[model samples]
Target: MRSLPLTPSRPVTAASDGRPALPPQHLADLDLGQRQTLLAGLGQPAYRAKQISTHYFGRLTRDPQAMTDLPAAVRAGVAERLLPTLLTPVREDACDSGATRKALWRLHDGALVESVLMGYPDRVTVCVSSQAGCGMACPFCATGQAGLTRNLSTAEIIDQVVHLAGVAAAGGVTGSPPRLSHVVFMGMGEPLANYGRVIAAVRRLCAPPPEGLGLSQRHVTVSTVGLVPAMRRLAGEDLSVTLALSLHAPDDDLRDELVPVNQRWKVAEVLDAAWEYADRTGRRVSIEYAMIRDVNDQPWRADLLGRLLAGRMAHVNLIPLNPTPGSRWDASPKPIEREFVRRLRTAGVAVTVRDTRGREIDGACGQLVAAETAS
Candidate 1:
């Protein structure tokens, strides 16, 4: 008998021709203002370092000359050391009339994750990754199939947003500095699995101008696949970021197959945990249900889901599953999807279908990186 072909095991950040991987040092791993102190030790003043950081973090400036306040001799050294490159884009694919762009980034460590920039009429939302690869083993997710690599440091995660904000700021998109109006941690990995760093990243993200990214906590959303302990742990944090649970199925039997973690924490445990979070935070919980063609999309499941969420302050985001190449699962048909929405609404549940952006460009959670793994 022949052995099964191994799924690609290498990180997705390798050079296109498969060269040695680069190592990325995360800024968050460093102490507060340490990057500045490092420069100060090298003959630059503390305030000069702050100026450089202001350009990078506040103004979203990547270019060194943009820091005009700095002396000519020392600016190069500051840029060389403090601005050590983090992620270099391996490939960028765009669909949806340039409104949706997916980028496969190669971190210095060769670890790979993805981020998506989506332009809507009202707001521009960036979907960012919290971990390099995922460990949750959700069968429908490409990253879950790859397994976990490591939790991205706070800076590694924020670099993605800052990079995009830099681009948008440079191009002058909408708001005065082309601010990122919204952020979602729904891209590559199980966010709560990497709780500590994720929380740190959230702080750095929601921090006001000059000190941090300046995005509002209300505009940020963090998602998880029902890590019960972590969810409860997060509720205690005082941060106002939205919490989204990938509760693909309402019952344990089906959920165990859809999201294997259900075997560890059953449906009741997860919902109880979610309700605890909502009660604690006074924020509505968002339940994410991916509608698979014949699996987990039944009317009975829809009503069950509504019953499960009925009296709670909750919102449902129904995703039409974006089929991966050769995967047995596919998105639900139109009529079934509409009926599912109708039944939920009839039950007085608030729900909406995800716009399904970037479908043409492997827009499902982890398809682009998965394809890179396959190649």
Candidate 2:
């Protein structure tokens, strides 16, 4: 009956809290000039950046042994100095008969993050974590429960995409190759909270071959719980990736409790920021609302949400709360869910239920917190 208690959280930058980055030599962590500088220091030609980037980003192969194009003598040196191994898979779980696979990665410091790969008919999507855990204390989110570990380096974030891209290219699970088409930052961390590296990582993902992995900027998405300044900053980046604002509740009173960051930047402010993102990128912003039973799912709230989103150049993704183990929150009942959908439609707001994947696998972002603790 009383409002849920607020939990403390803060925005994380690229190690702005004094968290260390991935080792300096990590190539994906380095910029173009930095990579070239590292290469020159190794007594290798600057042009090797292209060859190395070709092998790593374009081909998605991390093993130096596989790059016969590089002179065998320098391959090890290039890899050693610029591309030290970042993630080692700790466990891999698959469901939907392998159409969906979740990987738990152990970072160099033994910090763990999770990424999910889902294959649909025409394309594959990888959900990557931008931080090791998460700092935003959204009460219903599993990642929010685990708290912040650290912001992932650009390389660590890219590694998730690279590994999954490799999977798609090789027909690893489906037995027929498909290009990895979509990337969502809806995995573990508060993406905008870690703004610098996240934007840099986006650049690396969208840059042309030999400089980046060359994925189209349009296919990528960055999500946040309304970090206002960073959202404004992102609008000016000239990158066209979709911005997903996790607006779990319509009113600031509820949102302040649900998405704690909403305490600092309330609902209207966040929505205004989302609109600016749409205006700048010419991309429809994505509004993500998680439906929690009897908590934020009342019909009146749906109407409130509809009014808020009615004509915005945005799409609503309604997520049936992936109830964490032993948690008080649960998904809205089926009929309630439908009625909620109907209310939004009545208001002419476009909305769709996001497919609830990887729940049984504890692959919903930091949902692995419960699973890893049990193990």
Candidate 3:
């Protein structure tokens, strides 16, 4: 087995990628005990940790003014130290009668990333980025094409969830539940590439009140472009969050181009790790395949995919390729897409075409950020 690379638990003062390091530590970066320790060092009572946590996590407000429970003298200090602004909303575009919203955020260092909020009658879901940009180099993906800036700190990742959750609770998503219930790490980066921070963020997001936003672990979905080592490690962590494998193509030959990581870990190896994850967690794996026109959407590939997943605890999420600007890729036609679904079903593999939400507003993963950067 290839040894996994070490990922830092806290942001460094500088990044090797020529991008600035992540912002200072935020409350979401620390566990309950760490929070207490931090407050004690600042000459504040340890119990103040819980009080501030209640205001931030439970109330979902980062404004020190909104945290009236804290003494005025301490509020400013605590807020400046632990609640420094991390994400500045640069732009937000809404569609689907306001059921779908995509937000472009400028990080403290001016590196931009995006998150999306989508609401249905039953639930509200937020898709968040794990990195400012992506290193995967999946030719058709906007973020991948732009390349990596830096890994987001654990707090940076969690802040996206908390902020969007607050928006949902305020009825920002039309005709839907007024609370955010689901989270997907599918916005800009290859999540597992920033393994340590992503795992920390997940734990913080799912922990109960005063510690986290109190979300169910099962409601969180983390997508990867087949980071085999990270997938195996995640299974051992005992987390039950859904694991989504971005297996854009069923065959290694085509996948090598669509998802360059395939060159390192072949299709069979990646799927084996995914199956192991499913077996250990008892959570069905999600196979994410992007249907690119005249690319990997051939009928034979669909049959091959079905054969590979037959009888496995997996579901195929067929994504119609959302074309990035100046990209040669395009979504498969309706007939081609329907036939792909049919083949998977005929082979007894569960499949569904992903809803193309926010298509008009540059909805696919990094589209919004890409446009912002270009401008």
What residue pairs are clashing in model 1?
Answer: 22-108, 23-108, 24-108, 24-109
Instruction: Rate residue 308 of model 1 by lDDT.
Output: 90
Give a tens-digit lDDT track for model 1, residues 81-106: 66656667776776676667777787
Backbone clash total, candidate 1: 4
Q: For model 2, how does the per-residue alpha-carbon lDDT over 157-207 read when each residue is reduced to its tens digit?
A: 998899888977887556334778788998889998788888889999888
Q: Model 2, poorest ten-residue lDDT window?
A: 1-10
Clashing pairs in 3: none
Question: What TM-score would you give candidate 3 relative to the actual structure?
Answer: 0.94
lDDT of 3 by residue, 1-375 (tens): 011232222223456886676588899999989999999999999999999998889989978777887789898898788898888777777888889988788777778889999999999999999998999999999899999998999998999988888889898889999988999999889899999999999999999999998899999999999989999999999899999999999888899988999999999999999999999999999999999999988999999999999999999999988898788899999999999999999999999999888888888878877786777
Deviation (Å) of 260 in candidate 1: 0.7
Please give the distance, in angstroms, between residue 214's alpha carbon in candidate 3 and its true position after superposition: 0.9
TM-score for candidate 1, please give it: 0.89
lDDT of 2 at 2: 14
Q: Which of the numbered candidates is closest to the native, going by highest TM-score?
A: 3
Cα RMSD for candidate 1? Answer: 6.1
Give the residue spans of candidate 1 off by over 4 A: 1-36, 172-177
lDDT of each: 0.81, 0.84, 0.89
